[model samples]
Target: MRIGELGNETGVDIETIRHYEKIGLLSVPPREPNGYRNYETSHLERLAFIRHCRALDMPLADVKRLLDFITHPEVDCGEINRLIDAHLHNIRERLHSMQSLEKQLEVLRARCGDSHIVRDCGILSELVAASHKTGVKKD
Candidate 1:
């Protein structure tokens, strides 16, 4: 099939397919007699796998490593398990940080009970007072 047809079937953009080829994620296909690039089922399957990895938010390097593993099915899957575990750890850390941020914002939100003039706003006053105490000018 042609590039456009491959892209349509895979639900990936043509430019992204080209980029994958450029980045060595996807192999370049041979051109037909009419000079159109001819893609095969292997390309479609590989592209689908790539798209699934991307949907999982896996990094490109990790995806490449996973693809390499796929190419060599004899390799032990322990490394793949380790990679996924590491990614989960990172995600948990981020979630904890986000929760902390949410708590901090809740505290800040509680500083203001009602709307007032900008100068009389409790949140603004607290921020200004904190900055003054810290010897930092408010931006």
Candidate 2:
């Protein structure tokens, strides 16, 4: 089928599909006499696998490693297990960071009791003070 048909069937954007092909993630399909790409069932299946991995927030490099494993069925799955574990660890760290950020925002929110003019805004004042002290404009 054509690139548009493949994208519709897979729910993947045409540019992304082209990018995957460029990056060697998806195999280049054979061209027809009219010069359009002729995607086969194998391409569809591989693209589906890539989409699944992306849905799980897997990095492209990790997806490539997983694809390598798929290509070689004889390899043990211990490495895959390690990769997932590491990703989980990274997610947990991000969760902790987000939680801390939430608490900071809550504190900042508490600075103002009610809406006021920009000149009299406690939150704005605190934010300016913070920026001056840290050299980073964060509130």
| Predicted candidate 2 versus true structure: per-residue lDDT over 63-103, tens digit per residue | 99999999999999999999999999988999999999999
How far residue 21's Cα lies from its native spot in candidate 2, in Å, is 0.6
lDDT of the candidates, in the order given: 0.93, 0.94
Candidate number achieving the greatest lDDT relative to the actual structure? 2
lDDT of 1: 0.93
Total backbone collisions, model 2: 0
Those runs of model 2 whose alpha carbons end farther than 4 Å from true positions after fitting are 136-139
Error of 2 at 70 (Å): 0.6
Query: Candidate 2's error at 38, in angstroms?
Result: 0.9
